[model samples]
Target: MTTKRILLYAALAAGAFISVFPYLLVVLTAFKTKAQLNSTEPWLPGVPPTLDNLGRLLGGDFPQYILNTVIMTVLLTLGQLVFTTFAAYAFARLRFRGRDVLFWLYMATMMVPSAVTMIPLFLIMRELDLVNTWYGLLAPYILGTPYGIFLMRQFFKGLPAGLEEAARIDGAGPLTVLVRILLPLCRPALGTLTIITVISSWNSFLWPLIITSGDATKVVTVAIAALKVGIGVDYNLMMAGGLIALAPMVAVFVFFQKYIVRSVVLTGLK
Candidate 1:
């Protein structure tokens, strides 16, 4: 058992190092000079690190991209929380005709790849005159996603019924009970959903690229992509921008890592 535990620890450590290697390389490259970045010498770590690349990134349109990403992340997270929680609650506890059938249909949509829906969704947005607007980016997410609803529904199912019963005994309306009792108890699930939505929305590339043209609605990922030129790419500047884009995600993970882990555990418990 001791030997097996040691082996497991070794394997886990190796996996973690492998995962972090690329990020470490990016951080190193972010601080390298343009010559160092493109030189035949290894890009792993520059002999003398410099912040000139980082300064260039800070001086550009990177700040606007960060703002756009934050706005999109916050909007998408809040929208998903509200809509998914309500839909999940209804699906979990409410008894209406065709509820199961409707939920099944919703779940089926999950099997459909986003690539398949991209062109049609874009056309619809264009027709509605939502192109090149924040609304264009946020509108699709406002309707609640199937995976979010599924997660919330599972969490709601695990909740005890007596809380709602007690709330009713106190003359609390259904909405009041949901808001005051159910939502509070579902914090872990909500945290998980928030993390997932924020990260996904923040890192989104293809769809946002397809819908929003130019700086009108350019997100951080798109902005980073645009930094590359036709023939020669500025590796240092691009890495600096990439590092800046990664800071928020790292901050979120550092602050909410505990809650995120608990949420994942609760998910498996269900």
Candidate 2:
């Protein structure tokens, strides 16, 4: 092979190692005992791999945290998908006064940092007495996101107009066209949205920590944060919890990776 091609391959290999090394450390650390974790060989694999950390985590409130995270992720993803799909379809296909202006104005919100809205959202939740409730944890997110709407809108715009026109000629209304025709055709985009939404909701820490309290409402991310004791961080248990929290997202990405790539490629085409 040419020297230039060899250099390119070496660069790619270095980048891949950099990306995966932390995760490899976490996984290795998860199996190690607390003693091994604290010892000089902390960077190495467990001397004798143990499931004590996993056992302890599952035996405690961690399972409940996992369940809560799953429930919140599923509910929020469904709500966002529904809301974003309708909004995107309207923005892409319908002609209303100031539609372009309104859509652009809404999309501009994405430029604003989420931190800027956190206070106002928290105050709104407090006013509604939803503080520490599941509703509060979900309310700000279920309404759809500017990015999700933008993605769906782009995909919708890329679709052939004639499909909707044909559906309309067949006595289908706008809602019917959306539900029966457009939605089925938008599977790749929907899959991409579902994966993104699920992962975001699952990994959300700050909002959940702020809105939720106690074991009853705490999600996996908050539960994992609670692992930090006053004395010192328990790296083994923390890594175990991290792996547990990461498993679902990994599974999701593995399953829907193709669709995600397809959506990106198609969105670029649009």
Candidate 3:
């Protein structure tokens, strides 16, 4: 048993190093200057590391891209959470006409590839005169997704029915009971959702690419692509931009990752 455990620890340590090596290289490269590149020692950690790459990346239009992405991400995350929670609570507890049918119909849409709907959605946005505006960028995604509704509904179902009954006996309204009682206990699932939402919103490229024009509304992902297009052959600066773009997702995951593990463990969602 001791030998097996020792071997397991050694294997885990090796795997950790292997996974972390690329990120470490990015960090080192982010700090390097154009002069630091060597054909012989490509991965060389430069002595007296310079901040020229980072300075150039941050001291330009890149921050606007980051700011736009951040704004959209926050809006989408909050919008999904609020709307998803309300819809899930209704589906789980409220008895309404065509309830299950409506839910399943909505869920069925999730099976369809988003790409299939993109053109139609863009046409609608353009018809609404939302093109090249924040409204256009946000309109498509502000509503809760089917997957979010399903996850929340399942979690809501797994809770004891008696809890809501007890709240009702205490004269709590449906909204009150959901907000005060259920949401408190849904931290793990919500956290998991938040992490997923933030990452998805942050990395969103395709729809934003279609909706936004020029520098005004370009997101981090678009800006990164622009770096390759505009500033050809500045690898160090590009890596610096990548590091900046990567930081928020890293922070969000570090903060909310426990919820992901806990949600899987408690909710039995794969």
- Per-model lDDT: 0.88, 0.89, 0.85
lDDT of 3 by residue, 1-270 (tens): 699999999999999999988887878888877778553255678887889988887889988888899899999999999999999999999999999999999999999998888899889988999888888998777779988889999889988999999999999999999999999988877976777788889999888888888788889988876677653577787788888988987786687677766755755662
User: Candidate 2: which stretches are off by over 4 Å?
Assistant: 267-270
lDDT of 2 by residue, 1-270 (tens): 999999999999999999888888888888999887777475588778899999999998899999898899989999999999999998999999999999999999999998888889899999999999988999998989998999999989988999999999999999999999999999888887887788788889889988899777899999988999799888889999998988877787688788778766755665
Which pairs of residues collide in model 3?
none
TM-score of 3: 0.89
Q: CA lDDT of 236 in candidate 1?
A: 81
Alpha carbon lDDT at 53, candidate 1: 85
Candidate 2 has an lDDT of: 0.89
CA shift of 84, model 1, Å: 1.0
Error of 3 at 267 (Å): 6.0
**Model 2 misses residue 177 by how many Å?**
1.1
TM per candidate: 0.94, 0.94, 0.89
Error of 2 at 117 (Å): 1.0
Candidate 2: which pairs clash?
Answer: none
Q: Candidate 3: lDDT of 227? A: 74
Off by over 4 Å in 3: 1-7, 38-40, 264-270
For candidate 1, report its TM-score. Answer: 0.94
